[model samples]
Target: MSKKTLLSEIKEKIDQLVNAGFNNPTQIAKRIHRDLSIDETERTINHTRGTVKYHIHQSKKRKSNPALAQACQERGINFDNVGIAWNKDKHWSIQFRPSETGPTFEEMLQDHIDAIKNHNFKYEKIRRQNYSLPCLLVIDPADIHVGKLASSFETGEDYNTQIAVQRVKEGVDGILQKASGFNIEKIVFVAGNDILHIDTPKRVTTSGTPQDTDGMWYDNFLIAKRLYVDILDKLVKIADVHVMYNPSNHDYTNGFFLADAIKSWYRTCKNISFDVSIAHRKYFKYGTSLIGTTHGDGAKQQDLPLLMAQESKKMWSDTKHRYVYIHHIHHKVSKDYHGVTVEALRSPSSADSWHHRNGYQHSPKAIEGFVHSKDNGQIARFTHLF
Candidate 1:
């Protein structure tokens, strides 16, 4: 065999050894060195201990990611930011950031489309509402934190995924009953103000802060999804609905993905529209009103007015009344800037252990809604406190 062929054979043998539970680099090297020394033909390779160590490393890497190595070889591009975590079962978990030339944007987008299609969400068409009133209903179930856990013994309040879902349904029902007096033409459902307590299966937020969680990450996600779908179904019957997603810090990435999935779920519903992008702040225009929604973890309260004006310039200019609803403080604070009103809405989620220990349990739990007129600005505000 050629030298290249011999080297490939040696690598395959080392990989086989690795798969057979020979994970100790030093022991594997000694075994290979001894085997090669004993075999006269394989002795052509005078593999020193250092050479055996190199081969062992290469074998482990290849075992961890054979397809990735082959792809890199074919594309002539190396992957950076490689990481390996050793398992107790003598296996390695490999992770790496995608290479610069890994997948084109179109390819990634197509993959996402295929994934969405694979979900096979049952799509039902929503009938168009013919309400002739020029009024808008804004329902914001803020800071639900679906997976958060709080015990009555520790935090003086019991909160869990079940409580979180029940509160949203109850709050929305209350808001709808109160707003029954108004002639509504449109409904804006503000979503994703830390709707999830944890972003990862490790029971932590997106930024890696450990959390007091009540349920599994995926279970809570499904619970929140069902809650939103149920609420949107009700809202669409009353008026055309606009779902605005406010990306938050706790479940930032997961929240965006959930929002995207919701949008896909209602893709065929003509009465529902979606703003599910990853933008931290989202703006919606209603008649003479310009409303902004944000998670309130980013940017200073004082700066939101100018930021709103800059971000939604056309809406700011066209509307006579402007409001920015923010969450994450869990308390209520409303202030009118020079031309904009910034309101930090209250949350219905009870305090978890951290918040209760930190003395942040004073704020009353509530879900808020606002009613706006086409000619006038915000005419009514409703708070359903739990």
Candidate 2:
């Protein structure tokens, strides 16, 4: 084969793999190497990982918008993300994000507007039912780690993006089924407690700690977004839902962005409310029961009771029963303090390389839920084990 033909074929292969979701250069290189074993082609181009990366960049540059690409080049900004959405109206929306330069305030606002416009959330107003035995149901699927990877051979349990999604759905269904006997007036869906495994494409946490990841960072973000949307959609049918966000160490920045995206998604819904702020601890009061939520990485467990009381002084004074649900340790620890009960929830994600190596194993992986009476505080606890 000719040298020109070999190079063209190499570029084609690279494009095909990238479109098929193998975005990493090393992954594409291995796949192409397995498919094409021609000696002449190997000698002509030598499709190493670096060569694959070059071809991928060239391909992306060719497909990018000329004016926008030029502006990014002038600003020394690298395109960090590219996405395509196909609407039911047969229209396509293409988007890309600049890593270094990022977007202006106006552009960010426009993106949020576009997100709402692209998809129609036909949410009809859900009527509230008068329940004789009213209670607040708290569904805290803590430490999901949606993009974390764990091989059964290494960690004694297999985990990936698919497993993470499945386990959450099953766990939520299980909790709802268990709580079906009670009249659920309101739901506090605890979100953003390390829902994503990584914050950056470099396979690292927000603080730059390296991690073993499963899917691409963007894919995991979308997966978590869809998961939250689906859960909220279902919860709203049963009762009025309140989404509480708890910013965690891992995926701290991305987690906030995800919560905002979810907030935008359900902007039209009347039955769902959100507390997607960047607060380290979030408090919600239902009747005489006041519940606090935190990711629990920064503040110590013993100090949580005083912090809750200090932070939400009005709620603390008004409510008779108080509880703070915390996550991050992936194990169970419950302590009743002077006026509050601080409980660290369990996680559904299995141990990855770091956790497995450090002897963090066998803590009964499960998703937990709590049923709180109007004046009696937390009455029932639901556990869905893996």
Candidate 3:
């Protein structure tokens, strides 16, 4: 056989041994002789050991004298090719096999670095466009049961109405700050249902009669309304405002009332639009996208997409991009469903703990937030805005 052909045959044999987990030199040499039908007398097993030891020693030597060992360990390294050294202190190392299966370590690392830089450039380019323009901050502040109490896991600190409100304020502030950085066209607010405590009268529950002051329901509604209005009024300074309201089952009777009151108040405010329609319906539209808000009470968890699609088809048949933002389960599920993207939002409520005892414990600890870009025809994109 020609020298080149013989060398190629030897390399293939070595690869087969490596893949079979026969790393020991003696066993590999014996297997090679058997497979190739070489004369056992002419082919000494010691020569095979020598070849394996030479390759291993070369790899170790590359760590110190890389210039001399590079040609033996790497491909395309003629005397004229440029040379590079190995970094021994790195946590991970990559070794090339004779099979030529994947890129060398240095090449892979360089590609990864270049990819990161490209991604960063794209993000910066997006940020530069529409710089300092007013942004339309769309937020779903759902299930903020003001009178609910949280356990140790929910809050490191003890649970109280005061603590819940404070925690929610932090989330609201984070969303506001993120939205402020973008060029906001308008701010759309969707207050999800279960905003207040509608526990049965004092004699019923195990928590020794839940607190319900005379104006507790009304006062809680006022508190949530005032907080929401104050935040929106501040955001409106940078952009126009639009509000969407959806009622939940827990407080559907009273929650709808509170939602109506806020909508009525917004009608009086200048430069702000309010849409207080029925629960579980498409209540807002932005460009080619139509948003449907629901408290997630009527349908099963797995049936959300079907429910939203059916609702969208009925409400606005010409809607290009359909989105359903629901709160109640307090878990975040973002995925494409039957050509539409469905999202189950996480809540800023302490009452989510009650769900755990009932065997539903996938809710997110941190509140969920999202930023929708009208520039792209996308329906919804979720983020932990807080």
Candidate 4:
């Protein structure tokens, strides 16, 4: 057999494994290695992971877009045999060749947009019954990672879209239940900050490198959008809702999409408001207490307070009690920067293989919230650990 023919065979196997959602190089190698070992005719071949990666590149083909793989998977269609090309103009589309009759990337994109467009949110005008002490209920759903996947064997913890959704639901329920006694006047629903597991259709971060994902980007976006809707519905019944979005490292672009969609969803709802702009740093005022939120990927911990003051001078001066909520580090961190309090919220998200293998483990998965009083400021705190 010619060397070129052998290379072609190896490339074909790589394409098959990649289209089946084996993105990691090591995982792909193991997958194809088993294939070579099982087939009697190919039993004599000795190939490593590095060689497989080389063949993938040499074949002038890359891994199939996760979005296309997911759409095909849903329809019980194998994307391995389908011809796909990556179009980067808009939101990374998988342009398919005319031969295979399948869902076009454009159609999938339109499906999500249509879902957002046709959403009819029936917001019943809800007014809180007989309130007493006034306080702000800040529910920070830190690092939700809605579509993240974690293997128990690889990460020592099991997590997926279902687990993520469950944890968020459980966490939010616990916080609200615990805060039931407080006369919460304002519900500050702090969101974004990596609520999604992936930004691009290629299952990568904003920087364009592949990452482990539980589902397709569009599917996950819809799920997360629904989750936020349910959450806001509950919160609005309690008090006026104020939605804020802080762009995160993983899903900055998609996060904005979710945030804006929520804003549009609550357009008719009088009590609901939004701070869903592109700024990574965002500020909110609850009487005298000033609050700032950011994804915490760009700036240093110590620098946040200074940045906050510099960015919003008028708010910093007017408010007596100033606090900043930063998310990215998946554990609890509280540091008093003298006049300003800089804190990082804890995450309920279980680490994936990459995080677990690299000692990114933090135990006692939980959600945290704080109650800020007008006169006293941050008078109470709540945490629900899973």
Top candidate (TM-score): 2
**Tens digits of per-residue lDDT for model 4, 35-116:** 6554535532234455654555433332335665666678897555655545456666556642332233454455455545
Candidate 3: residue pairs that collide: 133-183, 134-183, 134-184, 134-185, 135-183, 135-184, 135-185, 136-184, 136-185, 136-186
Question: Model 4, which residues run further than 4 Å from truth?
Answer: 1-113, 116-118
Ranking by TM-score: 2, 4, 1, 3
Cα RMSD to native, each candidate?
A: 15.6, 13.6, 26.1, 14.7
C-alpha lDDT score of every prediction, in listed order: 0.80, 0.84, 0.57, 0.80
Q: How far off is model 4, as Cα RMSD?
A: 14.7
Task: Name the 10 consecutive residues with the lowest summed lDDT in model 3.
Answer: 120-129
TM-score of 4: 0.72
What lDDT, from 0 to 1, does candidate 4 have? 0.80
Candidate 1 structure lDDT: 0.80
TM per candidate: 0.69, 0.74, 0.55, 0.72
Evaluate candidate 3 by giving its C-alpha RMSD to the native, one decimal.
26.1
Ten-residue stretch with the least lDDT total in model 4: 98-107
lDDT of 2 at 254: 88
Estimate, for each residue in 138-213, the C-alpha lDDT of model 1 and write its tens digit: 9999999999999999988899999999999999999999999988888999999899998876789999999999
Q: Quote the positional error of residue 318 for candidate 3 in Å.
A: 4.4
List candidate 2 stretches off by more than 4 Å: 1-58, 61-115
